[model samples]
Target: MTISNDLFTRAQELIPGGVNSPVRAFRSVGGAPFFTKKAEGATLTTADDKELIDFVCTWGPAIHGHNHPVIRDAIAEALNNGTSFGTPNPYEVEMAELIIKMVPSVEKVRMVNSGTEATMTAIRLARGYTKRNKIIKFAGCYHGHVDSLLIAAGSGALTLGKPDSAGIPEKLAEETIVLPFNDLSKVEEAFSNFGDQIAGIILEPFPANVGLIFPTDGYLQGLRDLCTKHGSVLIFDEVMTGFRVSAGGVQEHVGITPDITTLGKIIGGGLPVGALGGKAEIMDHLAPLGPVYQAGTLSGNPLAMAAGIASLKLLLEGDAYSRLDKMGKQIASAIASTASEIGLPLQVPQVGSMFCVYFSEKRVDTLDDATATDTDRFNKYFHTCLEKGVYLPPSKYEANFISTAHEQGAIDRASEILCETLREL
Candidate 1:
């Protein structure tokens, strides 16, 4: 057997599904996952010694690309200081200040261990601030593995949520209101009926988990206005899109301010980190300041802070975002052209460095549309591209990221491979 296959066999004996995360199992793409030996500059060197052009970008953390020297150097310097200290560190303060400067709505911020904690704390803070229990979340917008947030829609459009996973309590699910994404009338109706009861509305402004789906025109602004009218907090889960989308994220891009923003991925600079930040008035409700209690021992680890600082500093360098956007457009346009040439219906939604391919004629503005895409054809194309040395996000439902390391040549190469793969299909 191959080294990766052997590793998988050994891993399955110790780790559930032979992977730490479910999606890493490659279940959606129908194959055993490959183990990476090393990664650098938009490429993963597999344990079996093959190198592939990486589009997964560590699921959105490797914006500067894998193992960037700046981030690595920062981590090394932090190592001299010590990895973690129980007491607060200067790096924590600096990181918090940086976040406030980057994201405008965040007048105050709290560090957490993962996206789940960031979202969980945001939900609790909202409930405490509004004195309401119910929360509304758009369908297919993943906020993390938090129990309350791990819910799906019930039978009807406006029905109370049901647990998407087995371990989540049904009572917690009951307090969650599930609504179809991008449907403003349904949001208005829900607010009309249960506005007073809703503590908050949480969503990924540009939902990436279900595919890179964008909001309908004015849909996000409408949610913001409705939440304002109802006195419910609006939380944007920017775990995937936060720094990857822009230095300020979708809120900054669209000019729609949310009461609370949940961030992860790039903020940690490839380490484990998450943050919850928003207006100080609402954030003050959290402990040491207010009644709501949330804390983490490694919330602001020095190493994570150093890596983040370096990563953000690199992002601040000249024309990084412009380069990322240009690369994304290049790949997206090439894929569209190839699809047209092949007489195949395709939808490639892209913004900045994030993009996803949907083999469907319909525009995927909502989760329903995303789910209806031609996943079978996508699966075939995915493996074909992989065999040809382009590593995509194994699942068709996930978004593929273009990093700063994805220079024009690399982007063109990946695009050519993708087009050739598509044509073969």
Candidate 2:
């Protein structure tokens, strides 16, 4: 048996589902999940000693790619100072400052241990600020497993065929109004029905968890207007898209501001971190100043802050986003062109460095559409790419990522392989 297979056998004996995360189990795509020994640039050296051209990019961090020297040096420098401090450190101030400077909507920011924490805090802060109990989230928009945002969520939940997670109180789930994405009418209807009760509306701006679906024209702006009209906070869950999409993320790219923005992924520099940033007025509602209480001892770990600062600085250094976009298009276009040639029903909705392949004849714009994707064929395609040494996201419901570390040659090779695999299928 392969070393990865052996590792999985051991992992399942201890770790539930043989994986730390549900998607990592590869249940939707089938087959044993390979364990990675090391990663560098845009590749993962698997436990079996096979180097796979990584398109997952550590599930949407690694904008500069795995084990980047710059980020590594920053972390090493911070390590010299020590790990976590019970009190705040200089890195926390710097991270907060950097976040405020980069993301247009985030005036004040608070660091947390993970994207889930950031999102959870944002929800509580919103409710506290607006004095309301309900939150509206789009169907298939996964906001880090916060109980209130788990209704009809995406990511692992969608992959596992269970959108509404168990264990959440029925009343808590009721307070979360789940609506169709890319459809402003549903949001308008929700607001008309429960305008006064809505504390906030949280969304992924571009729903990457459910295969990178973008907002239709004016759809985001419409939500912005609705929140403003109702006095409800608009929360953009950019944990996936945040700094990876742009210096300011989708808010900056599309020019629609949100009251609160949840950030993680690239901002953590592949470390465990998350932050909630927003108007000072709303953020001040959090403890020490307001009633909403959120705390974490490891919120601003020096290593994560240092690494994230380095990652953000790298983006500010050159035309990194443009380069990543070019690479993304190269792969996305190749897949599209090949699928067209083979007359295979396909749609690869891509933006910046995030994209997903949907084997559907029509374009995908809603959660239902994403849920109804051709997973049967996609399972075949995913395994074929894995065998050919390209590692995409394990499930069709997840977004595939590209990074600046992906050399032109690597991207070209990946594109060629992906297209060839599609044709063969």
Candidate 3:
């Protein structure tokens, strides 16, 4: 009597792969995905009426936990005012002001419907401002589904890019240069060959797409310096790390500010929202101020703005981030210790409330390193934890998130289950 299985059967008839998002299909972990009926605090009640301690946190937006009273109340209140006015709203202005005040790099911000919209718009603005067609991005850093950025490496180190997806023209991909993560030398080489034509370099400061990989010492600072030296904008795609890593995002943590920043996830307060912000000079290249054009009918939806304000206001109060760091360290240390005791090859990388467990003997510093992890072992562990009432991210490539609502007791229970699972493995 698995409700999730029944629903999944029905979903397959209505949606592609029985899921809207590919990751949600549980293809990586090899199982039918859990259909959650409700979520509160730090737990999710699946359609089968099973309660599990949630670690994904809705892919890093549930910092205050799912259905937080403040955010829910705000959404309910906004519903009374109606949805989608298709015009300027005061809530949008308030959300923008909060972002500018909190993020050191964002002087002004424009709202879009999703992270993809934000990254796409930021790249277009960069090209328009610098009058350059080429852009540089690191491998495994997913900015969105932009065609120009959808490129894989060619045969050699210095070779140009090839289309990772069909329909992306080779000419469009040529404008994008792909490089290895944390390799400053490759970045230099790309700039050496096409620096003048390179409009900007975009990347995730703390990449979470392929597990949690932090930038090497001075890696981010080097990018900032290089972009400044080359007169090209540096765009930090903080869509995943935005408020999850720290209140000011990873830019604040690293002390290296980018010329432009793209944000999503927590900023939307669990709704569909994305933003691109930066120095006035670059942002002015968008819309009425410059030739670059970007528009969205539901860009700054009032409901999303209200929820965002509520969430940020809560984060701004007192020591939320400190608590999050404490919790993150506790979980990482516990899992690491357990893996060691059970003779499991585990590499746990953590920052603030985000963490990832890579089942590999080698340290995971890049996508290539992360890919080397034993997925078969992880798949076994994933199901084991799921049976023990602990919910983790389905893919090894995705990071686990903790919320302010996750208590010490929940962590202890999850850690004990993980330890037992490792021993069994």
Candidate 4:
């Protein structure tokens, strides 16, 4: 057996599904997951000593690419100052300031340990601020595994949401009104029915979890208007898209401002970190400022903060975002056109540095449309790409990411490998 296979065998005995995260188990793509011993630039060197071009980018955090010297040096410098303080630190304050400056909707920000904590806190703050219980989320937009958000939409907007996972109380699910993405009429109906009870509407401005789908034109502004009309907070869950899509994420790119924003991934600089920020009024509702209670012992680890600051600063340096965009377009456009030419029923939806390959004839915009894509074909393509040294996101449902590090010849090679696979398919 290979070293990675041996490690997986050992891990399965000690950990659930032999992986800490479900997707990392490679259940959807049909293979044993390779354990990476090291990463640099846009590639992962596996335990089996194989090098593969990585498009996952550590699941959206490594925007500057893995093990960049700047981030590494920052982390090293911070380590000399000691690790945890359990009290307020300068890093947290600076990180907060940087977030406010970049994300247009974030006027005040609080650091959290994980995207789940950030999202959970955002939900509670919204409810506490509005003094209402209901939260409206879209079906395919994942905002962590918070109980209220772990819901699937019912038959219609007026229907109560159903639990998408086990162990979640049915009553808690009802507090969330899950609706189909890209449909504003359903949102209007929900608000019309529960206008008085809705605390806020939270959605991924770009639904990255379900194949990186973009909002239909005017869909975001429509939601913003409804929230304004109903006095409900509008929350943008930009955990996946935040720093990866652009400095201000979808809000800046599309010119729509939300009342609250949850962020993670790139902001953490490949470390465990998350944050929530919004209008000062709504944010003031938390803890020492107001009634909503949220606390994290390691909210802003000094090491993570220093590394994150370096990552964000790197984005502003020269042409990182532009280069990433160029890489995204180079690979996405090439593969998509090839799929079309070969008569493969495929759709590759991409934006900025994020993209996805959906084996579907129809364009994917809704949860139903995304689910209907042919996973079998995608699984074959995924394994083939892996064999040829390109590592994409393991599932058809997850979006792939590129990094500034990909600008140096990686983009062209990835495009060639992907097109070759499409032709083979």
Candidate 5:
């Protein structure tokens, strides 16, 4: 009956902590992670035969929900043609064009396998083009596990990143200056101290990795202006927010364009795809054009491209974003009202379809505020929701997602469960 325990017993012998990813171990919550067998629409059928209303949505890729027929059919059609060619394909060009059209700031784009690769390539391209060595990243804004960007990694690595990973050299960490999120004074000070040597400033414009923290008014524009003044590249790591926040991502929503933007999640349509895009002049710095070398055998894989095209097509079909905004507001309001009724200290930060429920009395505006949350209370809430057949992101530091598949019924049920859970807690 305990499927997660059995799977963990077997997986630990093969994979580290019984998961390819660290957070799946359920370490923060102190429980066995459910082994998912199948998923359809907004629900995940676990190996134990439990059907849960999935809110994590595979950590943001299943924006249209799991096993979407259009995306699946596209992948199947691609599989019939061939798998990998390790060469150019028409789908690659189509995917690139779709990205260029959808994201306003991505004038040119290069594909890779994961967000880590996209960010790594973006940083490399900035360094190559600017001929500078230093980079700036904000605390608790995770841009994947890339060595140079690990100074204050969030999500799964947040608790263990005090020393910035075991293998990353101190010299590499020294090159990265980690500052507070949403703090313009710290950003200005960093630039003032090392503006000449800094190649780029990279951050998650919304800071979703440590929960959904929004930028202060004019904060993103300030970054753009500062980067322009200092002759440094501004890279918005929108792996989580790219397509989820709006059709054009956070950059368009905020009316500020970064020099580079890293995308993943919804753009890939639940596939393993990532891209870094920016001005053609800077993108040309990559290999086959300039000296910055970046290559991926599976970059622009046909199946991924097919699924992405299908997903993007579906997203472009109607006023889907307006629907997403409505859903986000509905769920956020429901949860907030319930929390207030129960006198539970909670803060729900939401943007579009992504949100995080922080078990804190104070408003969460920065990474420090996020860390101050009562994670112990969150673990209790998570287990309670899980027992009620609702699945949320396992860690308090992560965001919960809603997909097009989630209807009012699911949202209401989830809100009721959360309310009961908080009351019990």
Candidate 6:
């Protein structure tokens, strides 16, 4: 048996589902998940000693690729000082300052340990600020497994076919109004029906968790306007898109401001980090300034702050986003052109370095369309590509990421492998 198979056998005894995360179990892909021994530049060395050209990019944080020297050095430097202080540190202040400077809508920012924490706090803060109980979330937008946000969520929850997790109170779920993404009319209807009760509306602006669906034309702006008209807070869940899509994120790219923005992934530079930022008036509603209680001892740990600063600085150094976009187009176009040549029904939705391949001919713009993607074919394609030394997200309902380390050669090689795999299938 392969080392990964052996490892899985042992892991299942100790860890639930043989993995820390649900998708890592490879249940959707029908295979043993390979554990990574090490990673560098756009590749992961599997436990079986195979080097796979990684397209998962550690689920959207490896913008500079794994084990980047710059980030490593920053972490090492921070380590020299200390790991955790429990008291406020300089790195936290600097990190918050950097976020305020970069994200246009974020005037004040607070750090947390994970995207879940950031999002959960944002919800509470919004409710506290608006003095309302209900929150509106898109059907497939995963806001980090917060109880109320778990209904009709995406990511592993979608992959496992359990959008609504068990053990969450029914009343909590009811307070979260799940709506179809990219549909402004439904949003308007929700507001008209429960305008005074809506504390906020949280969305992934681009909805990367459910396979990278984009907003319809003027759809985001329409949400902004509706939120304003209803006196509800607008929360952009950029945990996946922030800093990775652009320096200032989708808000900066699209020019629509949000009252609160939740960020993680690249902002932490592959470390466990998350942040919530917004207009000072709303942010001040959090504890110490207002009634919303949110606190984390490990929040803004020195190592994460240092790593994030290095990652953001590197992104700012050159035309990184442009380069990433160019590379993204190369991979995306290759997949599209090949699928067309082979008469395969494929739709590749891409923005900046994030994209997903839907094995359907129809354009995917809503959660319904993304949910209708062909998983059987995607599983077959995933295994074939992995056998050929290319690794993508294990499930069809996840976004594939590209890193700065993925140059033209890697892109070309991955494209060829993807095309050949498609042709064979």
Query: Candidate 4 deviates by what RMSD?
Result: 3.2
Q: Which ten residues in a row have the lowest lDDT in candidate 4?
A: 154-163
| Cα lDDT, all candidates | 0.88, 0.92, 0.87, 0.87, 0.89, 0.92
Writing each residue's lDDT as its tens digit, candidate 3 over 123-182 gives: 999999999999999887877778876664211111111227678888888888888899
Give model 5's TM-score versus the native structure: 0.98
lDDT of 4 at 284: 90
C-alpha lDDT of candidate 3 relative to the true structure: 0.87
Q: For residues 70-92, what per-residue lDDT tens digits would candidate 1 score against the true structure?
A: 89999999999898998999998
Tens-place lDDT per residue, model 2, 1-425, is 99999999999999999998999999999999999999999999999899999999989889999999999999999999898888889998988888999999988999998999999999999998998999999889998888888889999998888998889999888898988898898899998999999999999999999998988899999999999999999999999999877889999999999999999988889899999999999999998898999999898999999999999999999799899888888889999999888899999988889889999988889988987779889999999999999999999999999999999899989998999899889
RMSD after CA superposition, every candidate: 3.0, 0.8, 3.3, 3.2, 1.2, 0.8
Candidate 3, residue 96: lDDT? 92
For all candidates, the clash counts are: 0, 0, 0, 0, 0, 0
Against the true structure, what is each candidate's TM-score? 0.97, 0.99, 0.96, 0.97, 0.98, 0.99
With candidate 6 superimposed using the best TM-score fit, by how many Å does residue 262's alpha carbon deviate from the native? 0.2
State residue 262's C-alpha deviation in candidate 1, in Å. 0.6
Q: For model 6, how does the per-residue alpha-carbon lDDT over 1-425 read when each residue is reduced to its tens digit?
A: 99999999999999999999999988888988999999999999998899999999999999999999999999999999998999999998899988999999999999999999999999999999999999999988999979999999999998898989999999888899999998888999988899999999999998988888888899999999998988999999999999978899999999999999999988788889999999999999888899999998999999999999999999999899999999888889999999998899999988899888999979998778887888889999999999999999999889999999997889999999998999998
Q: List the residue pairs that clash in candidate 1.
A: none
| Candidate 3 lDDT for residue 123 | 94
Give the true-structure RMSD of model 5.
1.2
